[model samples]
Target: MNQYSTHDTSGAQLKLWDSAGPFETGAMQQLRNVASLPFVFRHVAGMPDVHWGKGATVGSVIATKAAIVPAAVGVDIGCGMMAVRTSLTADQLPDSLSAIRAEIERAVPKGMESSQTANHVKGGWAITPNSVGRAWNDRFEARWRAILARHPKVDGKTSDQLGSMGGGNHFIEVCLDEEDRLWVMLHSGSRGTGNRIGTYFIDAAKEAIAKERLDFHLADKDLAFLSEGSQLFDDYIEAMHFAQDYAVANRELMMGRVLEALRKHLPAFKTDKQAINCHHNYATRERHFGEQVWVTRKGAVSARAGELGIIPGSMGTGSFIVEGLGNEQSFCSCSHGAGRVMSRGEAKRRITLEQHAEAMKGIEARVDEGVLDESPAAYKDIGAVMDAQQDLVVIRHRLRQIINIKG
Candidate 1:
């Protein structure tokens, strides 16, 4: 039996798994807009955690033939999750989680007002650790310099930012899986350099559309796309791949930072088990339904059968490590995390500091008004989200966050 409900729009179709949580009118309309696009392949797939986003709805999986939409991919080019199961167990952790949180915040730069901010973190790894330098020199630096050769504006101090975590939904946490094993899980992306690439390409596509006067009756100008063979399209795909690689390396660098911090407080441990690093907000070429096409997962994760992905809950809740079932209909994808139920502004206005604090009473995380926007109440019920996508993935490890560090 099919696990999705089909919504027929003016063009193509939308297969949504709405049993976990219902989407708002705007979110549904966004999917319909993509469906109406001329290059969209087959149909659109909306995950259970579907919600509204900047250009396209979050939790959307779009497959296109001969064209790619940069806006659909969003700004956090390679944003995703990375997790590692440490040798330590829950009982081995310190009685107070605050020390761990403090050490992590100290080791990693985070919560900047914007990527351009000069004073985001006090005394950030100013000297650039020898290890981080080695990691970048090994692979990242050369790729970035090549991208800079073509697009100067996309360049940034990648050396300083490579291992850093940016603000918003990005975070680092120490969690305990169902088996009581300790784990280090973090969320980040390609950082500032990726942001510039994503923004540059998204606008470049729209600007090209405006310059050449090519309009396929686009409902929203942000839906602009570049044809597969176009020069701009080639440039974007190359740049995007660079950012994706940077993001992977970025997470690896941060995981190293976290492990170093933990080593100071606890017994020496190894993070060689159950390691997973997957990208949720990126696009790539994949074959589905007998045709090769570009697949963009906005707020989704690739869940090819047996492949592992991480789906995290809110600050107070927990997370999941799942192995994909490779559901072809959904293009082998699933939700990235608990989709936000309210916007940041709305969350700040509606949720009180007291309510946020109460919600995260046990978790070692920020409860100040500054972080009220990330309150658990601001997001959908994660349990319902998992239940809704049962056919897409099977839960491997359910991890409850014991130490949450927000950036």
Candidate 2:
């Protein structure tokens, strides 16, 4: 068939494009939760990488009309992918990839620890922050000031957390495209700022319905929604917009640092082709299904016809540059990556370092114990994931990793 079809149910219609396989009970539960939303537009679209996430499925798309699910956007808020094509070819990279990784790790803070001088954990703002955070502070703080003026609880966090990559699936990689052109790709989000906004709004939405006769199961508390006309809803949109901007800026700033780190090894580097930064975890008002609706793409990317997007593979596998097909049934979306087959704890417990090293045989990256949870074996096969969404996206480029940096 030209395009894989979606599953339609009594309450909602859903298009599941999984070249990968059928969903597990956990994933199915999350999908059902999303489908249960009253305002969900048409059917929910589940990408090949569909997996169980905090409140919703990780690789699913939830398009809604009047109300928006803040949990569907999740706490990471603006989590997405960013990649840059550099002028330096594969030949320019040094045989020893350790220094390149070190440079990148040093350039950007990649852990849970604060690199800042002070703490601003109260509300959401950080205390003493880094240059990247400082640059974003003034703008975000102004917006936060306005938000807090109304809801004093919406405290601002430091931007020092902005450029820092968080733990778990988040990563940075130096890859080579099909033609052997070098590219750098990474995944991150709004950090502390987005988390604060998301948490605050989600709590407000839940409390807003505290006394209402809400169906517990039929009413997903996590799917706690904020209607467009409400004050909290407006604040959410504002904070969400700010977080999205922070996420994009975070990726840009980190990418710039990555380029600078690369220059230490290959001085003639210039980023040009294959450079893209996009948000997969945010909401936007758009005309879809013949009406103006707020599209909340939690783990899905905007796959409008012919749009360029990154579909990354596991640490040891190949990623893709895809052209969106704009499949209306899927809300014009596609998978983010090869979804996890198991949780991080499970992967760490089941996969071994030797297996990880074996899977990543050709790639120049860390095979240490800390990354065992990120082993290729821990994820669904990328090839299968791509095959599932044949109707959603067309592969434009196949990328293989050379050097990978993890946080």
Candidate 3:
């Protein structure tokens, strides 16, 4: 059975779903802060992957009546996972995947620091606003323009940031499922444009609160929020929606590029019948507990009945494709992945090159000191993370990486 701890305040009641053994103190503190908020609709739901994050815990589901926290959505707006089944099997792959990895590096712009950011940039935009961005921008440009007009501070360069990969923990991989079928997977978010948009709005929210001289126990400056019906709130919503679209397109564009890379080395292959891309860090309006509210899922994947989602493992571990169980108590959500057990800085300091190389021996991925922080040891056991939420999502596929490109 799922276990929880609850807290009550005059403003709201909060519930945190966590296993007794693995919950972190930092996560609990963030939960406490959210519970103290005045407009919180119901209890805060924490998933097994719970960890400390900027405004809210990473693996939390927070519902609010009429206000939205910009930082809670995070700088990587619409950050999520994407995976596609392929016709290729493990047996079809070459003995050494180095060629495949190099081909992918050539096809997709993987590492931004090494690649010419200048080529990827246009008019001070970070992502180059490729065809994908242009199409999506055109569809929402009218709304975007209107919002920016009202809030003139809402920079318009975010559109050019689409289709780019952001740094840290974001990655692209080629994997083989338990049954040996190939799967291409990646994780990224709205790039420079998204960061600028998020930062600008977060400051605006804080300024709005400061202007009113409101009094409240804010856990972190990142918790500053825009109240519903306010002009700033409207602008954030519109801007965030556009960022979400950009994020989705960003992954799609990367996936296309990765596939092209595979074609360069592997035999002619086709994508399988199924593919899934899901956002785990964003908010949307949903009906729950007989009321309509904005549900913010931070490092939590929606687990509504029959919903398909991706739960990635750390580098050198197994990843899963899952179907939601629609457990209402969890806000119909599941953990995004095996949560980090240590900060990247700490992980890099704690783990050794020998350990990382050994763990990644069979995989075609980078093993240099640069990627030590993302070593599998830095994250919770994927098996344990999945076992903790058997009731939340049903496993559809268990995948192991063969080739991984960390960004």
Candidate 4:
């Protein structure tokens, strides 16, 4: 086991797995702030990719008793990665991947830019596909109606954005593993509807705190939480679970579309049905340290023993398929990715398009100024991150992208 550094805070010790690399002070402060919360369990665990986030540190795992913080889970509920290995080898891919990339972009609506007419939004489905509608009605319709009946504000929003990818860090990629095996990976979450559910609850939590006159002082207002046994808490959990399911379905739909696109471009191929679908941003009820608690992995993946998970790298670097060792100190969690070393705005201002293009050399991805913020230099080294989390997970497959698409 790698030696972990510990810092004593007001309520619990902050366990950090970042001694092998630089630790940001802002993230440290956020971790301490979270640790100071009254209901925080044992201690807050900081992953190697820890960075400062809105209410809590992005890569920190917070296990709490009797309460749940909405913002700590963040607005992008159930945001995660899904990757599937295909029967086709790297050699089977066509020489030019431009057409395949374009087909995927067409099949999945990406980015925030939307075209609107008298009564339609072009960014989402004009007419919901039969498959998408069936999936929603079968899996979500009844539960969604219940949630809407309670929270009327989120009622008007439909599932039109169910299969669409949203802007910012969400992406799709075609990659080759070390054995030259092909895979398709994507990152996304429950779309507009999830955002509505999350925001509504966050505000509701804050209002409850004010109304009940809770005497706790929070470092950030976004840390407002709904206590266990409260009506709002039950409602949030139901809605959150629904959004999580939506996110998984969203990825599955996009994967099906991408596979169809690939079939049009390449020879016959089949995907391994045991593909991975894991969430990095979400909370769940679990047992730990002899008690039940809510474990919120804000920007971390659950690494329960022998569990499979995806740890993606930056646009140009290599990603990994990993197996968990279930280190208890980390609450059995691992870093989501090579966490951003710089903010997007900072990267855009500091990194030139020439440097961005150079960093992405050999990868078939957008190298324009618009994508400068997502360049490899904008993120921490993936190799170093894996090294720091040596006890949390074991690398299974090393994947380098041949083609990348970003929203």
* Cα lDDT listed for each candidate: 0.87, 0.79, 0.81, 0.87
lDDT digits (tens) for residues 366-391 of candidate 4: 98888888989999989988998889
Full-model lDDT, candidate 2: 0.79
Q: For model 3, how does the per-residue alpha-carbon lDDT over 1-407 read when each residue is reduced to its tens digit?
A: 66555643434466555543747877777877887787888688888888999888899898889999988888778899999988888888889889888776655554455444334433223454356556656665676677667766656555554555666788888988888999999998877656777889989988888777667767677789999998778878888887788788888877887888788778889996667989988999999898999999989999899999999989899799999999888889999999999899999999999999999989989999999999999998888788878889999999899888887
Give the C-alpha miss distance for residue 119 in model 3, angstroms.
Answer: 5.7
Error of 4 at 317 (Å): 0.6
* Per-prediction tally of clashes: 0, 11, 1, 0
Candidate 3 has which clashing residue pairs, if any?
303-332
**Where does candidate 2 stray beyond 4 Å?**
7-12, 114-134, 214-217
* Per-model TM against the reference: 0.95, 0.92, 0.92, 0.96
Per-residue lDDT of 317 in model 2: 91
Steric clash count of candidate 3: 1
Compared with the true structure, the alpha-carbon lDDT of candidate 3 equals: 0.81
lDDT of 2 by residue, 334-399 (tens): 888888888889998999888888998878788899999889888888888888788888998898
**What lDDT is reached at residue 311 by model 1?**
97
- lDDT per residue for candidate 1 within 304-323, as digits (tens), equals 99999999988889999999
> So what's the TM-score on candidate 1?
0.95
